[model samples]
Target: MKTRNLIYRYLAIISIALGANFANAQSFPDRPITLVVPNPPGGLVDTSARLLSEPLTRVIGQPIIVDNKPGASGNVAYQFVAKAKPDGYTLLISYSGYHVGNPSLMDKLPWDPVKDFSPVALLTVSTNVIAVHPSVPVNNLKELIAYAKANPGKLNYASQGNGSVSHIGTEIFKQNTGIDLVHVPYKGSGPAIQDVLAGQVQLFITTPPSVMQHVQSGKLKGLAVTGKSRHPGMPNVPTTAEAGLPSFQLESWVALYAPAGTPAPVIAKLTESVKKSLALPEVKERSDAAGVELRYLTPTAMDALLKKELPYWDKAIKSANIKLD
Candidate 1:
């Protein structure tokens, strides 16, 4: 009788704890929330976070604050979000470089992209453009390849860091084109662009948002964009395929993620908000103006995307023979 009573008491305690957790999830955002962006304050990820803050705060009846924690090719912020309580109050604004590609490039990543976080939404995809300093003497992708081959190690390309998507993409480009350009890694895209503009670096395969203004102002010569089709911001820019490389399509994407084990109801609510935000005309226009395409994906859709892209990157890494020490 004593053992049976003890078992009943343990079950009762477990049931009560679960019920309270569910209740807390249901009443999520009872206070202000924080959206931690894993990049600098002025980048695309931070801009997207600010875009969602106002409307989401209105819907949740709480202020949404953005915190920028940029480092480690975004591993610093990724780990911070991973270790956060499995509550909906703290969310992560993620990038593909941080979540998917980093794991494949590095020997050991501190957090498992899929297992450590729950997908909230895949928000937007901004294509990268291959731009060079005006002195490179290359007008198009084919010409650039010929120039690179002729010049050999005379040209150096800058990426945000080692293991970044920019770096990986550039490596893949080198393999595809059979060119050997030196790789220069910067602390972040901001510095990389700065050096590229100052002509300290001669080439860069980087996102349009970071380099669009320079392209518009004729500071950097646009070669080709890494997308399937034309972008609204640079309609005349040819894609890599159109420029003779069919296998070079890349996009700088941003997504929202929460610590794993966050409640299903909370995820649903967040996904709905994302869809709604993407559909807004203001958001679409603003994002487009910034060279970003406003795209929304359900959590399931995003999960499938992650799965597909992981193998693709793995193959690219192997093909390029890229190994980070």
Candidate 2:
């Protein structure tokens, strides 16, 4: 009789534990959710975060507030979300560069991009354009390569930061072209673009959205986009491959992540919400105007993408000898 009673008691405890977990998952996100943007205001990440707030709020029935905590190339926000109570209230809106590239460049990051965060969904991919100062006298990639070979380190290229998307893209371009062009890192895209226009830098690898206005005004010349296909918005501009640099291709993508300990059901729901938002016509239009290709990925697919990209960027960083420390 005692053994049977013991079994019943054990079963009762198991049932209670399961019930509590079910309750927690079912009642997940009962409060306002904070989407942390690990960049300063007025940047691509901040803009994307604001764009997502309304749609996500509507879908989740809770106000989704975007918080900008920019520093260490998105390490600040990553650490914040990683240590936040894993109750689904805090989230990290990470760019592919930070999730994939920083891990290889930064000496000691506070959070593990893969292990400390749960992949929720991919937001969008924003491609960059290779623009040079008007004085460079290079009409296309070949001319630029010729000029760089002759000038060598006289040709300096500015990027958003030391280990930014543009910096890495330029590095890859240099590796493929076998040219010697110096790299100049700025605080963010804003300053980099400003200096590039003022002729403080001879070349810039920047995103379309940030440079489209200047390119339109003829302040900066659009050389090539770092994508396989030309952007629809900038049909006149050729792709890196089309411009004669075959291996130069890169894009900045934003994705959602929660603390690793968050419940699977919570991740599923968040992923569904992001997917739904991306499917909306207005969301698609906004992303397109910003030169961002909107493609929502499931958590499983996001995990796969991170796994693939991490190693690729690691190799690139090592080959380029990039070290943030």
Against the true structure, what is each candidate's TM-score? Answer: 0.88, 0.90
- After TM-score superposition, the amount by which residue 152's alpha carbon in candidate 1 deviates from its true location, in angstroms, is 3.7
Q: Measured by TM-score, how close is model 2 to the native structure?
A: 0.90
- The alpha-carbon lDDT assigned to residue 52 of candidate 2 equals 88
Model 2 C-alpha lDDT per residue in residues 179-204, reported as the tens digit of each score: 99888898778888888898989998
Could you give candidate 1's per-residue lDDT for residues 185-216 as a string of tens digits?
A: 98778889999999989999998877888888
| Model 2 pairs in collision | none
lDDT values, one for every candidate? 0.86, 0.85
| CA-only RMSD, every prediction | 2.6, 2.5
Looking at model 2, report the run of 10 residues with the lowest lDDT sum.
286-295
Residue 279 error, candidate 1, Å: 1.7
Badly placed stretches (over 4 Å) of model 2 are 1-15
